[model samples]
Target: MTEGPPSILSLAWLLSLVYVFVAAVFVVRRLTDKSGKELARRIKAATRGRDAATDAAGDLVKRHEMSGLRWLDVFLSRQAWSRRMDKMLAQADIEAPLGIFVLLSLVLATTGYVAASLYAQNPFVRLAVGIGLGLLPFKWIAMRKARRMQEFERQLPEALELVGRALRAGHTFTSGMGMVVSEFAEPIRGEFQTTMEEINFGMGVAVALDNLMDRVDCPDLNFFVVSVKIQNETGGNLAEIVGNIAWLIRERLKLKGRIRVLSAEGRMAAWVLCLLPFFVCGAVQVLNPGYLNLLFTAPLGHILIYLVMGLMTMGILVIRKMVRIEV
Candidate 1:
């Protein structure tokens, strides 16, 4: 008969007000900044003699605002949202503003909270679930980004082989990359196409490659960077160096695939074991009602459950470590 702590509507209103205040301060500082003005001027200058796409790009950069919350930005840098956005953008071929993602994150958090609240039987349990849901998308995005990076790494040697052949045939790096865009398919082609444009717009090859590496964070790209850097420094046959690098990468990728195959069963077992307790508890509470109520209904039961969860989590990690082979 007791009322819930507060409706989700109330929580949303509080969050909305805080977001508005933060946004307003951000806007105010941006409006007063000479740095923003200088950057805008530079973009205008860069795109002045260019075509419609370049002009649109200039406008997009000028309008793309990321100000305030420097602390949060730094913290999230450790969390890797930029890397996630990069892969998502490349895959989806979406050119929408980054702010759209910020909004999407909030919406995702709310959906998490609502889903948790509906499934959880107790107010305290529901609150805990809601908080977890709120942070779920960030973790989800990180996992998605990692998977995409793995895929990209697996495909990189092939892309490099294509580029190496084109470069040896007397094509400039930019043109060679454009060849990649035309000849290859999604992900590699799309990412290279963007890099090609960035290079055309006055960005240096090294800088563009670094930017691309930042997006993927793949180990294969690290080797490619090393090859390029060495070629730039020592004046060797760049094509030969790239071809050798591609061979090494392909071997590494093959090894990684075999290791993954060997580890799959262990990883699945760890996942199931870790998840089983929570699912069983949830199902029991839903079906029998009183069966698992004692856990939350008593302090001792709550502490015992928490201890069990901690142990189970530790055990899962141990199994995960056993199966994880870093190549």
Candidate 2:
């Protein structure tokens, strides 16, 4: 017998092709990657040392600038959805092209739709599952962004203190930022590094700071930036101001920690209540698949399942709202 066009084998092939394409793109990118800034730094060194070999290497880098998946960028640049995804990716410090991410999402959604349509035999369920699966990449990006922001928050006070110390040691503001870039761990270090580069690239202090604030999306960073700008304008002691901001951040962080601890029980209860039904249903299904098959076969069973799912969703949202205490 001949196989149909939309057989399992064909779907698997399609999924494999997508994965192969993604892997090839990323692997090639990694293999060919060069550091644009590093090359510039080397060119400066070569000029200072008057070395012909170093100049040649730096010139080669300039000639062959590092390339990314710019085709996707060109194609998706006009779309609003792609723009929003780009912003999210920027905040998350993701270096992948938005087009590539969207392509992966499309492939996953297509696979999910095909597979679920075959197994679930319900159009609504297939659509829902497909969309949810498609959004998994974005969900991952959001989680990464949240984690980076949390780490930034944890490190911001210490970074500020270091910057203040650098200023007190009679360094310029840019030099102080360089100190943070050198002393701090990741996320914030990268932020300061970018800002320093921006300033070096002819951007003003206010503009570079605004860019930093835009990239990080942290209010505490906003406070620090604004304080620095104000101190710069008014000719006050910037070192003292930044130190005070650091101390203030410490106190606010302490209060926020207390609030989080106090709300831990509510969060735990919310999670338990939200996931209990699914866990019980899974247990029952494991015990007897035939028991849940009735829900797929009977009209009344569909109604009950729909009602229960709706109520569970509402309960989850309510609990989310109740437990989310913003500082």
Candidate 3:
């Protein structure tokens, strides 16, 4: 007797497993690959469009591609939103192509819809799951960007003090930044190294600093860049100025920490409030299996569920705004 062909569900599961394995491998390679080959490739691609005339003139400003595929790169280049996404990826230090993320999101959304259909018969529930899963990539990007910016801000004061010491030791400003590149760890080191490379490649100090500011969304970094630009114009005691800025940044960080500590209660309350409804719903389902069946089976129940969800979202936003004190 011959075996029957696999069911559609089995095929879907198999495909999902393969996709997950491939994505995991890709992520691991991206995280561990430190050969700088990718960076070199991007630099080469960026410079490929420049003429020798521009090269000779030392105008080596390169336009980076958003995707590996020529068509996708061209399409992304034309879209403002894609450019913003590219910048967000850069801020997060993610080296993956934008097209990969776009494709991944679509795949995830489709997978989510299929998975939801296995347990949920409502179209709205399936759509909601799909949208939620589709947003995971972007949400992850945002979280990564936030963590990186926080780390950068945390390192800025020490990096600045190091630069200040180098300046006082009679090194040029660029030399001070180079020292930072050599001495500091990731994020700070990478950023400074990029700025140094840009300067070496004929980009002006101010313009390079501006680019750095664009790449980092830290207000404290804005202060450093503005101070450097001002000092270059006015011929001040650069070392003293840097030291003062470092001190100011350190104090502000301390104050921000204290503010977070004080608002800890509010943050905790917001979290509990956000999670309570889901916990209750889950408990109700477990305690009495069909008690909440109407919510999934009836139109009126669906309307109520949506309204409750909308109100919960509004409450969460308001609570977040109340607790988030900008320092």
* Residue 112 in candidate 2, Cα distance off native in Å: 0.6
Kindly report which residue stretches of model 3 are placed more than 4 angstroms away from their true locations once superposed. Answer: 1-14, 17-63
Scored by Cα lDDT, where does model 1 land?
0.71
| Best candidate (score: lDDT) | 3
TM-score of each: 0.68, 0.80, 0.83
How accurate locally is residue 272 in candidate 3, as Cα lDDT from 0 to 100? 96
Question: What lDDT would each prediction earn against the true structure?
Answer: 0.71, 0.82, 0.86
Candidate 1 residue lDDT tens string, 74-103: 444455666466456544444433333554
lDDT of each residue in 1-327, candidate 3, tens digit only:
955565788868767785986587467546644437645654665677666445533532344556555576688889999988988999999988677787678778888887778667688889999999999999999999999999999999999999999999999989999998888898999999999999998999999999999999899999999999999999899999999999999999999999999989999998898899999999999999999988877989888988998998999899899989998
Where in model 1 is the C-alpha error above 4 Å?
1-63, 66-124, 170-172, 278-289
Clashing pairs in 3: none
| Model 2 RMSD, rounded to 1 decimal | 5.7
**Best by the TM-score measure:** 3
- Runs with alpha carbons beyond 4 Å of true place in candidate 2: 1-75
| 2 or 3, greater by lDDT | 3
